[model samples]
Target: MLIGIPKEIKNHEYRVGMVPASVRELIENNHEVIIETNAGIGIGFSDQDYIAAGASIEDTAAAIFAKADMIVKVKEPLAVERAMLRQGQILFTYLHLAPDLPQTLDLIDSKAICIAYETVIDTQGRLPLLAPMSEVAGRMAIQAGAQTLEKSNQGSGMLLGGVPGVAPAKVVIIGGGMVGNNAAQMAVGLGADVTILDRNIDTLRSLNIQFGSKVKVIYSTLDVLEAEVLAADLVIGAVLIPGAAAPKLVTRDHISKMKPGSAIVDVAIDQGGCFETSHATTHQDPTYIVDEVVHYCVANMPGAVAKTSTFALNNATLPYIIKLANLGYKKALENDQGLLEGLNVINGKLTCKSVAEAHNLPYVTAKTALAI
Candidate 1:
């Protein structure tokens, strides 16, 4: 099989799909790997590194796409790259299709096999591919929010880790999943008061047991969410629903209820934010004021740390990529249930139930889609 790695073209996106070591692994498995020129540069891997690893480098994305059977990417295809997709080709990437009707339609029309990394599930019912990036984004949310809280940034001029005789900031996290957990860990480590809310009672119990009174775990009801937001100095929106759009937990009215100059870091902005006022911002310009409340909702938060993110992402995705390349997507899906769950759109049909439901399209089970 011929595998292609293209340079990520999203605004402020610097992570590459594959690194030199991963290419070497593919070569060892007897697969031909093709990388577009300087594809690994953002991640600090040079073209010479890939060449030394026995991989071929192409000068253009068109050249790489023309010959490769499978295309591995770090992010969803942009408009220009979407136009370059070919029928019967394999696209393995993080395709958050719920929010973008145009991109979803384009993928279907292209008649390509689209396996979304975010939708893949492990036996433990955990999102393995999405977890790594979520961990990165979650930790960074606090760092970004703390920066935005400085008076220079139009924030409340409060310090996250306050000095003696000064009160520490109140940090409220909206979910108890991977993103929220990491964010809470960071906030608590900085000596701030942290509260995490979730709809799952059992998960909340687990969190309470794990944290052991260090942080507050509350049952997430509208009233509880409102109360927490009203008193919070930093609000981190970490809600996620896999392939579906993130449910809006913070409404415009809620934003108005927040204290003046408080900061909201919506980590779910990529899947349509959990805040009513949150829009996809770039790392260059990552904040906006809504009702005097600052919103930092950069869709690709991990992109800010290109080298770390690329290596972390590659570590999690390489095994699956190897399976897909060696056995072919169909055979690999047939062999591993985890890999089967990654199938979103294949040959122009919608396979992920959440994605199809999000757009009112016909739905097919992942099992049924793989059989085709």
Candidate 2:
């Protein structure tokens, strides 16, 4: 099997799909890996580095896309790249299709086998493939929110960790999943007043035990969420619904009621955001003011830390990539139920229930789509 790595083309996206070490692993497994020129350059891996790992370097993404049996990418393919997809070709990447109707339609028309890394689950029912990036994004949410809280950024002139005799900022995280957990870690480490809200009692209990009074864990309800958001100096929207659009927990009314100059970091922006005012922003322009509240909604937060993100992402995704290349996508997916859960589209049919439901499209189960 020939695996292709194309340079990510999303705005300010610097993470590469495969690193030199990952390519070497594939080579050791007797697989041919072709990488587009400069695919790993953003993360300091030269073409020579890939070559040293026994990967053939192609000069153009077109050639890599056209000739490779499977395409491994860091992010979802952009419009042009999606246009390049061919029927029956394998696309293994983070396809956030629920929020992006156009991309879903394009993938369906291309008739490609689309396996979303974010949707893949482990035996523990954890999102193994999405964990690395989620961890990165979660940690970065605090960093970004703190920066946005600076007076120059039009945020409340409050420090996350106040000095002696000064009060620390209140940080409210709207989920108890990976992103919220990490955000709470950062916020608490910085000496801020941290509160995390979630619907799961078990999750809230686990978080309470983990934090042990350093962070407050609250059961999420409309009244509680609104009160928390209103009181927060910095709010982090960390909600996720696995392959579905993130619920809009923070409505426009809530934004309007937020304290003047307070900031919101919507880490769930990739899944359409849990904040009503959230819109995807780029690193170059990461914040905007809405209802006097700063909104930080960079969809690819992990991309800002390209090297760490690429290596971490590779650690999680390489095993699955190897399995796909070694046994072919069908056999690999058939062997792993978790991997089959990653299948969103195959042979022009939408295989993910959430994605199909999101766009009112016809749904096909992964087993039916694969004819297993």
Clashing pairs in 2: none
* Tens-digit lDDT track of model 2 for 17-117: 99999999999999999999998989899999999999999999999999999999988899999999999899999999999999999999999999999
**Inter-residue clash pairs, candidate 1:** none
Runs of candidate 1 with Cα error greater than 4 angstroms are none
lDDT score, candidate 1, position 30: 96
- TM-score per model over all chains: 0.98, 0.99
Clashes of each: 0, 0
CA lDDT, candidate 1, residue 14:
94
Off by over 4 Å in 2: none
Per-residue lDDT tens digits for candidate 1, residues 139-243, read 999999999999999999999989999999999999999999999889988988899999999879988988878899999998999999999999999999989
- Candidate 1 at residue 44, lDDT? 80
lDDT of 2 at 340: 98
Report the lDDT of model 2 for residue 53: 97
